[model samples]
Target: MEAPRLTTKTFHLQHGTSVYELHLKRLEADRVQLRGTKISNPEGSKALDEVEAHVQQRGNEIVLKTANGPHRAIAVRTARGVWVSLGERTAFFEFARKDVDAVSTQPVKTEIHAPMTGKIVDVRVKPNQKVGLGDILVIMEAMKMEFKLEAPMEALIESVGCEKGQLVDLGQLLVQLKTLDNKKA
Candidate 1:
């Protein structure tokens, strides 16, 4: 007989400027448990009590049962990360393995893609616009939650492929960019 698999997955998630560390483990058939800690919170103190939840996915929605209550959420997997919407809060987390430095290991890219299949709520820039790192370039809404797509680095907007109220698919190209030093491109 084979021993039951015991696999734990670790993830680093970024919401706005806050980072969270989460560990997920299977607790039983069709059920999983998640334990998380906030690594940083921009509004105040950094310390947070560990959070625990029992999660299960049903179709495109995820149901998380916590000490508070049951909450429904939506999660979409993208090329570089995952887009998650819980209650009225939505976040696109830049995915990284435990062995990798999430910030330092990212390679510069010139395209901004839709992190989830949602409607574009707003577009903040146009062609030739110069944006700094962490600038909000677009806003999207999915499953009743709004998500802000921010600039990963300083760049010049080369093109805008989306507009206000436009529906976008996951991984769809929404904007093209030219790095600050290579703006001519």
Candidate 2:
């Protein structure tokens, strides 16, 4: 049997409007260049800037470097939707796995995983610990940089799968949490 395909559909900020489309492939492990076009803007205006970015994933933090400058971002999968933070600017965008054309080929879960292979310098929370939204959970050191893994929402820690001094592989689960009342159910 042939392998299935996974696709993510999202709206990117184009000027001032949301342009919706399906994101087909990831050009590299961290860099993704999608195949789609938007018509919600002016009749012939370009929907997006031609961007070339080098993305580095360190735990929950994402660093994107481009011609403009470097940007720090955080990604979290919440019950309501995906939350992405780029530097001091943050935005929330909702997406359904069913709306993602690639769901058949991808696995979905709530655990926060390491974005890249790294050494765990610190494990901040204990199992079953109560944490508020934006609490720092782990500290990962990679490529001479230190990254703090922050909580996406308020929650009680279900388990911490990794320990300090442990080497975690990319996409390895580091922590799990039970969503608290402050978060959308």
Candidate 3:
């Protein structure tokens, strides 16, 4: 019998002023590898680096590991959008329908939520805090691993629904942002 076939997708990222394109291939047994290319010619030559990784589904928490390190990601299904975690260093990603591939198994939203029931290890933002699109909002500790929650959009925080050291449920509201009043003064 032939091995099961999986899908592949592409993504683009901008760090500072440089842009990169990433090609991701999903294999059987939950294996994924990514290769990145710099869009701008001045950045560098073309090269691809492969990482050995596997994904484990444990209820709400999806743990992904590569040879370099391991990442704990959270997913929350809301009426608005899907929230996903990139890794510990980066904030969560809030993705809308257009920003994600139709066939990808990952969530679409950039907003990071608790992957499992855990205590808030640290609250990085305060109520009414103005944050950028990828700012870190909170850090949660579960099963001795740390997960960072990030903003889905660039806006002023309307309210912080959770506090430091507070125990949060699986789908609890940790932070809320008010839409920017773009009207001129």
lDDT of each: 0.79, 0.70, 0.66
- Best-to-worst ranking by lDDT: 1, 2, 3
Stretches of model 3 off by over 4 angstroms after superposition: 1-113, 181-185
After aligning candidate 2 to the native by TM-score, how far in Å is the CA of 137 from where it should be?
0.4
Q: Return the clash pairs for model 3, or none.
A: 82-109, 93-109, 93-110, 93-111, 94-109, 94-110, 94-111, 95-108, 95-109, 95-110
> Alpha-carbon error at 66 in model 1, in Å?
1.3
**In terms of TM-score, which candidate is stronger, 2 or 3?**
2
lDDT string, candidate 1, 85-177, tens digits: 988998889765553345333447789999999999999999999999989999999999999999889999999999999999999999888
Q: Write the per-residue lDDT of candidate 3 for residues 1-185, one digit (tens) a residue.
A: 55857777875544433344567777865787777664432444355576657888787788988886888888664554345666554433333233323223332343445667999999888877788877888899888989988887787776787889999989887887754654432
- Report the lDDT tens digits of candidate 2 across residue range 1-185: 44434444444322223333545454555665555544342343234444656788888788988788888899886665667888677777655333323432332234789978999999999997998878999999999899999888878898999999999999999999877653445
CA lDDT, candidate 3, residue 64: 88
TM-score for each predicted model, relative to the true structure:
0.46, 0.44, 0.39
User: Cα lDDT of model 3 overall?
Assistant: 0.66
**In angstroms, how far off is 174's CA in candidate 2?**
0.3
Instruction: Name the lDDT of candidate 1.
Output: 0.79
Query: Which residue pairs collide in model 1, if any?
Result: none
lDDT accuracy of residue 58 in candidate 3: 80
